[model samples]
Target: MKGPHRIIIVGGGFGGLRAALELVKRRARLKSFEVTLVDRETRHIYSPLLYEVCTGGLDADMGRASVQELKSGVAVPFSDFERRVKKSRLHFVRGELTGLDEEAKEIALKDGRTLPYDDLILACGGAPNTFGIPGVEEHAFFLKWLPDALRIRARIAAFLEARRKGKERRVCVLIAGGGPTGTESAAELANFFQRMTDAGVLDREAWHVRLVEAGPTVLPNHPEPVRQAARKRLEALGVDVMTGTKLNKIEPGRACLTIADDGEECIREADVVVWAGGIKPPAAWKSLKLPVDAKGWLMAEPSLQLKGKDHVWGLGDAVSFMHPKTGVRVPALAQVATREAAIVAENVTRLLERRPAITWNPPEYWMTVTPLGGHHAIADLGRFVLTGFPGYVARKVADLMYFCSILPWRQALRLWAKGTMVYMRND
Candidate 1:
């Protein structure tokens, strides 16, 4: 508390980045406070558009931005800023964090470096949930990051290319889990295959897209009517929907599943496997001696501060805080992350000013937009749901709105125009 307060934030996801931005904005007002953001990855990925990247509907580069680029955009004055600001001293170390020594207030990195901090924020985000299924970690592809999306795209292209050479001449895609990510990915794959077949690049008879869900219906988080509409839309796109199916195991090229209703076992061969089941907190959090919920998510208060830790805060998918109204844990989504980020920013500001933290109330509009490939989408906005062409337009507009909200108006308009032109040309 004597020298400038050093605030170190781990993970460059939405929560961490937003906190850093807010800290930078308040630099002129504070006399002595330094913020350093750290992450294992070099770039921050927009996780929502990852499915489109995998299906070639959108370029992979469109879904990521370098951490350095993000820093540059914030315009923190280097002269008055902390020395770490010079020569990219933000400690972009690429390694796993081993553990935290609470007594010493230091973070031990895998590379043998210990970073001491006056305050810390954990925004490490979530990992793909494997449900303890065997062979999944080794063989299955996840859509969590840009690399995952790129790998999926490459694998799909390779599969298709191999088919052209009469190698089995059959392609099967099995997408596990039926959340928004899985549903959107399945639709994208169906659309990609349909377009390829229409253009004589792929054979309709040779390609198959299967969506597997353990729940009674796809989009288990959505309302029943919305789920039914999504199912119908997917069916129309030739995606095989297998509901009430629980994955038992995954072999080299096949998946063993048990039907939830009858408990009957079945095996299906797959050329490409995508695991979109769900997400869990990162493995690092499990080893930490901090307070965590039964689900392994960090237990944080409504103010986004970690339980039993005054100097530490948590947010995004890695932290679980119950909703004041619903009493249920808030779902992990970009919108939730954004709202949490603002609250965290204000809380951090208040903490710096020696004032009490403000209460964070959940936003009312928990809307979701799901793309159905080729300028088609489905949207559920709480009270109302829209599908087909109108839904697609709304989805595009919503995407633009999110970008516009975060980015400068000029940049946001450019992205919107570029996206519109690309979609039109592709159509």
Candidate 2:
């Protein structure tokens, strides 16, 4: 309460970055606080396009782009923000959080350093949840980070190259889970294989892509229309959609699954396995002894502050807050996280000024768009939905709008152009 108030955000994901940007944008009104954004990585990843990156859709023309080149299209350096917001009290610190002292109002990092903060925002995102499945932690490839996506691309490419050299007869990719990530990855990868086949780089019958969902259907949480459209697209792209199929375990080059109805255990051979199952809050949160839900995600009130702790806030995938009206927990989506960030920013500003904080209300126009390979997508806009090319256009425009929110127009447009051009190559 004395001197300049220090606001420290402990993540660079959608929520943390947006909150930091929002705070800096309000510097004129608030006047005297420094906002420090801390994260283990130096860059913030645009995760929505990660499936495209792994499938080579964002590679350079002629599909010769290196991993670094693919990375450029998705990773935005934290330093770029400092440059954009000149003379603002926004600082980026790179370190992994290891501990927190709630009473002392300080966070401990892996490098033996502690940062004191008057107000702390924990937006540390979730990790891919393996659901205690055997061999998954050691054998499955996760699509959570840039390096993970790059590794998948490299692994798939190596397999394809082997096929071309007659070293391998077939290449199989098995995707686990049926959420947005799993569905999109399967659809995009199918198209990627088709493109190579069309160009005589691969044989149409030499490779296979399959998606396994433990639920009754793919995109289970979405409306029926969205689910049907996504399933149809996946099938049309030659991806084998196995609904009500539970992945029992994984091993090198193989997967074990059982059909829900028959309980028939089957083993499938796959050269590459991608896990897009689901996400859970990072284990680091447990040590902080913060309030959490049954699933271990930190619990935040409608005001976006952690329960019983007005000085500490939470958002993104790390926190679970239910919708006041629907009584359903808000899904962990980039739009939701960013919107929550805006509300948190407002609430933080209100608290600093001794004003009552405002509640976070879900917007009516919140949309969910899932890419379905090669310029085809499905966009669910609450009461209505759009599919095919129109939906794909909506997805692209949404990306541009997100960029514009966090960046200068010229730079946003440039990044949008780069992504649009490369992503369209799969079409």
Candidate 3:
């Protein structure tokens, strides 16, 4: 429907970023295609490693540890995007996606603005889903963005100070949803508290960091051995691994939970409660009335295109991608999303040039590492497992790889090295 073909991609998370970067590269050939990448925020978050910002961000320069440090460490500003984006044909738009008209190929924004596109990619990413749990929305801390992570860390520091002044014996920290986020967060906080106490910052006895999961175990998607090993490591680090514990409700500074082991409900009074449970598609995507899977994630074809549509594509955590090889399951990890982006970019180019889209080739390997605070980690690579410093190094390398994949080499090196600078010199 157009004079220069327009491809509008929503959300600037990993998937949207990947697609945009590659699209800018490929658009040199497709002379008529104009691309615009959009997100409500002006910065892109390094989401998977948000736990580091929560625990690693310690600035002596500012009073009470600057929350802005969180911004500096985890956020890649839109300025960074501009250098890469504006250099090419892709454009960056800072606005929230309010609606989409598939029939007219147009998108509406929160400010009553609308966009017309020949092709649209909804890679808007996912939001923390509270699962309708009572009081969760009102009481829980989330780690989905730099701001949220800053708030969590600020709350944590405040709690520590308050408890220190009040002579409280323990700080109870609860993390709901025992997936990677919950586990990693629990580990990070547990270490942070221990280190703080060790450094004589506060007369701390212990911060009871608890990981609560509704499922029978943490990291249910990972191999059984990986789950077992991680649980053991977390437990060893004094984390209360409450597997099969469902958070029924969250009150102010307290959480009520059902313990499957005893089949009894209990109340946990905590200084802070972080909801690391899971993610869901943004409301704008839901409003589209597109057919979604049972879990409300948009459905995609083998070639990563939205089912029954050629010009519309769904990707990343917003959609359920059935791997052609791995049956009907695919994780919402950044690596997978990055891979999907490459394919979608190629296919989008292929489609524009009247070539058939290639089928999505599911990733061949699955790897993950959960660091148990400060340089100690547990890594899982299929059947192989590594625990301790080697695992920690692997995790660091993976994080480096992600930065390198998205940014220029020099910039990636600085970011990779900058993020852990405090930890290196014991600052």
Candidate 4:
């Protein structure tokens, strides 16, 4: 009620970062706000391109920069966060969020520290969900964080290295999920290993990539035509597509599955297994005293504020909303989070001014770009679709636009070039 309003934004995913950046942009005009963005990590990962990193696509030579540089090229460090937020009076705190003290308007970190805030923003992102599949937690690799990608890359390279040295006879890579992530990873792995074969590091018939989806088909949310096109492309690229196949269990060096076609049990030998099935709100969320949905996603008013409390706001994968049209909940996505961040910024500023808060409307259209790996991709633009080179170009342009909107122009352009060179190494 006195001096500048203290605002603490939890989570550094797209939503939290953008929200902080938006405040940074208006710090001059809005002088009554002090913002702090808290997160466990310093690097803001470009999740869309994370698959490229996992597949070792970022380890090649980009004209002037190595793909290793490009792997993090799209990522912005917390120091960069400092640069952007410095003049705006915003601060970045690196720590794990353990819980919230809503009664006292404070957030508790894991290291026995708590931050009191006049206003709180939660954007803590989603964690990968294995749907209770056994052994997956230990044996399968994930692709959510930079470390996850790096782990997957290391595993892949090790397998290839062993195979090349004749220590391992064959490799079977099983991907247990058919969403865009799983599909893209399968394609990239096939391409990456194929390059190994081209270099005489792998035998053409020595490795296999299999994708299993419990759903009726891959890309279940996309239009049937887009799904068909992607399916066709994947098959052509030599990724075995197993639709209606459920992952019963995953063990060391193998996976148990139920084939829907025959309703029979089967086991697939595997050297590497990847899980990209689904995601859920952070575990800490379930422990918070805030009002949460049945599945633990925070409940918020249409204004993105806690249902009955204005001091706390929610967005990104941490919150839930009822779809007015379908009467169902929607999954969190980067685009949606970005939009939600904008709304939170507006509403938070309005709250500081004691102005009426604004409501968030679900976006009517969003461009979904799914890279099929090795210079080709598919773009679903709602009414129609673009495939082949146009799709690839469109996605690149979109990436450039986002980077430009978020980062300085020079860094954005450099990232565009860096990403191009990294992916084009296959040629």
Candidate number of the best TM-score: 2
Worst 10 residues of 1 by lDDT: 72-81
lDDT of 1: 0.76
lDDT per model, in order?
A: 0.76, 0.88, 0.79, 0.81
Encode model 2's per-residue lDDT on 316-395: one tens digit a residue: 88888878787788888998889889899988999978999999888534579999999899999897898999999999
Question: What order do candidates take by TM-score, descending?
Answer: 2, 4, 3, 1
Estimate the TM-score for candidate 4: 0.94
lDDT string, candidate 4, 63-134, tens digits: 324445656655888677687655557788989889777778888899988888988999988889988889
How well does candidate 3 match the true structure in TM-score terms?
A: 0.93
Question: How close is each model in CA RMSD to the real structure?
Answer: 4.7, 1.8, 2.3, 2.3
User: What is the C-alpha local distance difference test score of candidate 2?
Assistant: 0.88
Candidates sorted on lDDT, descending: 2, 4, 3, 1
**Candidate that would win on lDDT:** 2
Query: After superposing candidate 4, which stretches have Cα over 4 Å from the reference?
Result: 57-67, 86-88
Error of model 1, residue 87, in angstroms: 12
RMSD of 4: 2.3
Better of 2 and 3 by lDDT: 2
TM-score of each model, in listed order: 0.88, 0.96, 0.93, 0.94
